[model samples]
Target: MARHIYACPLRWSDMDAFGHVNNVVFLRYLEEARIDFMFTQAAEAGAGEFAGGSVVARHEIDYRRPLVHRPEPVTVETRVTRIGGASLTVAYEIKDTAADGTETVYVQASTVVVPYDLAEGRPRRISPVEREFLSRFMDEEVVAV
Candidate 1:
């Protein structure tokens, strides 16, 4: 499957009481990766200005292992699994290069985001241009929502 991956360094705040990357922080890393991929690296895949007009309809996160805080950096990988007219489902993976075993998969997350009418505060169908733009993330075949 085709995928979009974004990499970033781990920050000091990402550590927890155990001196390893906290579980909750992984979700935040996923969020940052999603935003970067959709807006910067692949702006062509974004619908429109979703900062204040987007709504997250559903979210799922799976933690595979604990990330130890090391002097080196960790990377977050993100990709869009599928996209509908109004909704897009995105996935993420966080990993540390030094880690071995399943500890490789530090985190995984899936999120469904929908465009909304900022004025009416209700869900809305994506615009034609936006729909065309977002299709780039798909697997060459459109999936029904």
Candidate 2:
């Protein structure tokens, strides 16, 4: 079991009038991290087809703390929680780790993604290669519900 780590930069525009990152912007952060994981990293692992067409079927997010804009990037750790026949669920934690090794989690979320056949215009089953790539990051203990 492993976790994919992404360094997500914070932009000034992500801040809301209240001075913390807006709720909606967190979705974008998650997208960036998910893309890095499922597209870039997966392709390198021989699951390049995921980049062709994968759609988010559902998102479950819990905002744990407010995050103000900062120059340093926040850490987004992603892991596969469940893999269905046609869809997979990924869990994420957006956080900052201090020098002392303490972690301040800003958000905990999960997303259900379905592979799609763009040419055929419909969903598809999880390919063996794709499943193999995703299995590397699967964590049995982190069940998303």
Candidate 3:
């Protein structure tokens, strides 16, 4: 599967008093990558259909290591793990780059997102075009920590 990579800049505020990234901030990183993948990589029409068309139904995250505040960018890799009738699972890995150029994974996460219709106030089926665009990132194997 093709993973969409996003370079996430770590903010000082993202760290806690322990000098490592706060656990809650990891969710933000995942959200950024998900938005970038869906809105930027997907087609314009498909992207439009996604506007307020999805909601995170669940989030499962495993923190492997602590991430310290750094000037270098962190990398977030995102891919579609499963696509169902009304929802899809997006897997993510947040990694920090070291001076030696090694990447250490800090977190592994997955989010179940359901396509929603605001006007009708309910879940909606994934459109064919949207599925086609999302298939580009589909992976047969599940991503785990």
Evaluated against the true structure, the overall lDDT of model 1 is 0.71
lDDT of 3: 0.84
Taking the tens digit of each residue's C-alpha lDDT, what string does model 2 give over 111-141? 9999999999999999888888888899874
Error of 3 at 12 (Å): 1.0
At residue 10, candidate 1 shows an lDDT of 77
| Ten-residue stretch with the least lDDT total in model 1 | 39-48
> Which has the higher lDDT value, candidate number 2 or candidate number 3?
2
Report the error of model 2 at residue 109, Å: 0.4
Score residue 102 of candidate 2 by CA lDDT.
97
Candidate 3 lDDT tens digits, 67-135: 888897789988898888888898899986688988789999999998899999999988788887777
lDDT of 1 at 81: 71
For all predictions, the C-alpha RMSD in Å is 3.3, 2.5, 3.7
- State each model's CA lDDT, in order: 0.71, 0.92, 0.84
**Model 1, span 74-109: residue lDDT tens:** 677666677787788877777755534444777778
Predicted structure with the largest TM-score when compared to the true one: 2
TM-score of each: 0.77, 0.95, 0.88
- Please say which candidate is ahead in lDDT: 1 or 3: 3
Q: What is the TM-score (0 to 1) of candidate 2?
A: 0.95
Location of the lowest summed lDDT over 10 successive residues in candidate 3 = 136-145
